[model samples]
Target: MQTTRLPHDGPEISVLALGAASLGSVYSEVSQANADATVQTALGLGVSLIDVAPYYGLTKAETALGLALQGVERSRYTLATKVGRYGDKAWDFSRDATLRSLGESLGRLKCGHVDVLQCHDIEHGDLKQLVDEALPALRELKAQGVIRYVGITGYDLAVLEKIAVEQQVDTVMAYCSFTMQDQRLGPVAQRLKSHDIAVFNASPLGMGLLTRKGPPDWHPGHETVHKAAAEAARICAEAGSDISRLAVQWALQKAAEQGIASTVIGSSSAVNMSDNVAALNVPIDAELLARVEAVLAPVRDLGWDVLPGNGGKAGS
Candidate 1:
């Protein structure tokens, strides 16, 4: 695994970060021992950044992560978690709520201060509130050495871009995958790079649609998204690469090509994690990339039409 410098002069982190959402019971249930083993395995594989949030599994993810890092050197890893959301629940951006969230997250992770603290999924209306209220507190914490950097993450690239332009945060995390499926963040990536703000892309696999199992209509919004995913899979197959590998490689390659800092992939099992890591080694030829793009050309929005709260239920 390669390491990249954090934006705003913070610590360096692994290019491939391990997302802790799957370690919790939201997607599937894992024994505490298994979670610990997975965390340890990721560390051994040179993955230094672990992303978790208090809302994941109702704080179970953070608890599991804390237990996993109990005996390890805290400085060896760059820890990150979010405030402004709670447990598959709703989003809240109040100043007092932000403080309360951080306190609880720190207690759950058993850490005095986190390396990076993010404002999770803040919308346009809440942006000013965040800058006015949360920003001061976060800056205070950073000044006191409680946190090294501040970041903002969300599914909407527009919100990310707005924050990156108006705020001086250390990093910004967005969702960008291969196939130009959602080009929403393309410009945002360039903007962040110019500002020296590290960008972390999540959902490289588009929420498991690029895997061997193909897409599923898990929810109402997934109906059209699954169809688009299947089309992408077919196109990848015709081009000599599976959708799974292509999706991961597309993100890693694009991030490297564009000079973004890192991309995060969520994996529940060690086998799945290994498969994702193997994508870093897969060779994506010009022909394959071209064909993949052609196949995805017809669906420019790429099912973002069904995104939650956008008059659809994708994220819901």
Candidate 2:
């Protein structure tokens, strides 16, 4: 596995992070034993960074991660978890709540402090509250040596840009993928690099649309998402690359080219994990890259105009 340096303390993290969302059973049901085995396999494969959230499975994910890491040396890996939301409800950024949240996360993760602590799903409203209330608490924790670094994660590029410029965060997690089509965060990513903030590209496979077998309609999710998946499949076929491999490779190569430090790929099965890890070694040529760009051109326009406020629909 390739490694990248975190801006805070220069700790080398795996370029491909293992997202623990699936372990929480957000996408599908998973047993505690299965989640533990998944984490063990990831560590065996040299993946050091594990991303989990309090909201995932209402803290089940963090608990499972804590259990998986039990008795393992703390220095062997980097742990990241998020605050700001709880149990799919409204956002909360109060200082007291933030502190309590961290305590709970620390207890659940069974760690004295996490390497990376992020503000989860930030948006337009209450931006000042985060800067004034939440971030200061995180900074205080960092000063106290409870957390090594603090950061933010979200789908809004504008909000991420604002936080990156003003907050002095050590890292930023943003959504990016070849199936994204619109390439919404390309410029935002460049700006983040300019600020020396480590970048983690989330949803690199567009939430399994790029990797799953068959076309988009196979999934019973949103129509727009399925449509985008279909278009991505066509593009991959044109490029003579498997859509899954193409999607994963595009994210990895694009992050490398754009100076991103890492890209997180969520996996539920060992076979899928192996395939995704393998994409890091696949050599993509210039011609195939161009073909992918061109094939996605038409679908990009369809997704560009629909913003998140429009029902929080997928593929936008």
lDDT of 1 by residue, 42-93 (tens): 8887888989888777788999999988989988899989888763447777
Worst 10 residues of 2 by lDDT: 307-316
Q: Which stretches of candidate 2 lie over 4 Å from their true place?
A: 177-180, 213-225, 234-241, 285-292, 301-316
Which lDDT value does model 2 have at 217?
29
Candidate 1 Cα outliers beyond 4 Å, as residue runs:
87-89, 176-180, 215-222, 234-241, 285-289, 303-316
TM-score of each candidate?
Answer: 0.88, 0.88
Top model number, lDDT: 2
Clashes of each: 1, 0
As for candidate 1, its clashing pairs are 55-87
